[model samples]
Target: MLRPRKFKELETKLGHRFKDPGLLERALTHASVRGGKIARFDNERLEFIGDRVLGLAIAEILNQQYPEASEGELARRYNRLVRGEACAKVARNIGLGAHLILSESEADSGGRDKTTILADAAEALLGAVFIDVGFEKARAVVRKLWQEQSEPVPEVAVDAKSALQEWAQGQGLALPKYTVVSRKGPDHAPRFTAEVIIAGRAPAQGEGASKRIAEQAAATALLTREGEGGRLGDA
Candidate 1:
């Protein structure tokens, strides 16, 4: 059995106590260590419920905070915010990784630092909180946990064209150029087909609702091809 002192410390930090601390213990336990023992429930089911709770809480937060933003914009921010990397970052910030119980083999393989595991554990903890109390209490807990740390998400320029151009620049290669292969549809919403041509290789083609977006898609395809061939320059 896990000790109460550590859980008490965690509750102090989190500003809430579990009526049933076993839920939290289960949330921290990984399947790698637990083999269907009655006392050893893994956090997978908790992760599933927590995922929904997280999405709803984040959506409500975004909707309330950014009333004028389009749903697409809100969705983009939400996705970036709730992604594995983001969740792992939060887990690290809260020192949740320290509490995880994994098998010796898994721990030897660096399970403590694994982003996927950390993120899953964080979600499971949220679910545990939800189960221990209710949605309103869960929301309060989440808000308190995240509010001080939350900041506006920076926009990622991860589109293909930018990646390709960066790759070219890093390799001292010639810049890529994009040309429209075809265009169709109404003036207000045209579909553009673009071809991205690298200096020494075959051009890659992509289509999007806009020329810039299509060019970016094409650039991404070209980068993917180069990556597969082991030709992309060092990051």
Candidate 2:
């Protein structure tokens, strides 16, 4: 059983105390915990619901914030923002891991510090908050958590194809082209591998379920590698 004093401190940090208190208890409980009155429900269901809710909230925020941006660009930024790493970073910032009710094995295996676990827990926490309060309150909670990470529109183009094209144009290089390197698997579900080639550099390769997606992946890989290695401007 969690000590009353500890529960009080947790509630203080959470900014809202549960009326039933069991709800909050279940929110922190992991499936691994055994033989406890509060261990009946795990956090997985809440995590699932919270994932969608978080996506919707963030999507709405991105849509309003970047009206001129293409959907692909918005999607990339949205992906980065809601990714597990980002969620775990937010979880750590709020000291959420210390409040989890994990199994002994999980506790010893560094589960408390695991990014995936923390991210899932953060989503579950959001769901608990939404169920306890309301959508507006849940939005407020997420906004508070993400306020520091939110930024003004980034100057870097988020779409790989757009960025690659702009880079090529700026360097006075011939426009890059994508070619299918190979195809594999059944015709109905063929996997395509494509390469993006620029005028004077080694080509970058990517694989995807379709030719168009493969091309985009190739562009993404090439842009990422070039951007990081400082070869993009010279190409």
Candidate 3:
């Protein structure tokens, strides 16, 4: 049996008590540790269930928070909130990585800090909570942790590429350029990596499910970097 003290610390962070602490333990177990066959117990099943749980909670929140917004607007906001990167951010905020129980080999390979792993585990944790308690309790946890953290959704939802273009023009600079760095994953859900280059500045990269989305991600990355003191060339 896993130690009670370990789960106690995690419960404190999660803001919920688990009658079956084993549920939380299972939620934190990685498939890599189980040799990819989770017959014993792993986060995979929980991650699956949690994905739907998370989506529903976020949809409900967005619907309530942006009452007058169009369906398209709500969809955009929903996508931003439920993306893997966003989930990983929430996991980091709650220090979920510290409680993960990885095989020695997995931990040595830097599994603890991997964004995909953390995001999956975060979802699994939510799933475990839903299973242990119920939808409403899990939802309350999600709302408290996630509701106030998202950047305000724009009314029209401009793509990142257009936003960056307008910004560069306002600064009297040449238009920014984007390049497809790589494409990987299966055909059904390929991942695209894009790099955005600006005059006299280091390139910033981003990844997404499509070239256009990747380009938008790249532009957003560059803009965020520049906003955080990564300078751009003057007019």
Q: Indicate the worst ten consecutive residues by lDDT in candidate 1.
A: 226-235
Which window of ten consecutive residues has the lowest lDDT sum in model 2?
Answer: 226-235
Cα displacement (angstroms), candidate 2, residue 67, comes to 2.4
lDDT of 3 by residue, 19-132 (tens): 888889999999877875745599889999899999999999988888887664675577668878889999999888988989999899988899999999999999999999
Give the lowest summed-lDDT range of ten residues in model 3: 226-235
lDDT tens digits by residue: candidate 2, 74-108: 75677767879889998898888888889999999
Best model number under lDDT:
3
Per-structure clash totals for the candidates: 0, 0, 0
Off by over 4 Å in 3: 1-3, 150-157, 160-235
lDDT comparing candidate 1 with the true structure: 0.77
Q: Which candidate ranks first by TM-score, i.e. highest?
A: 3
Per-residue lDDT over 55-89 for candidate 1, one digit per residue giving the tens place of the 0 to 100 score:
88888887887788765456556765676877787
Cα RMSD, each candidate: 14.3, 11.2, 11.0
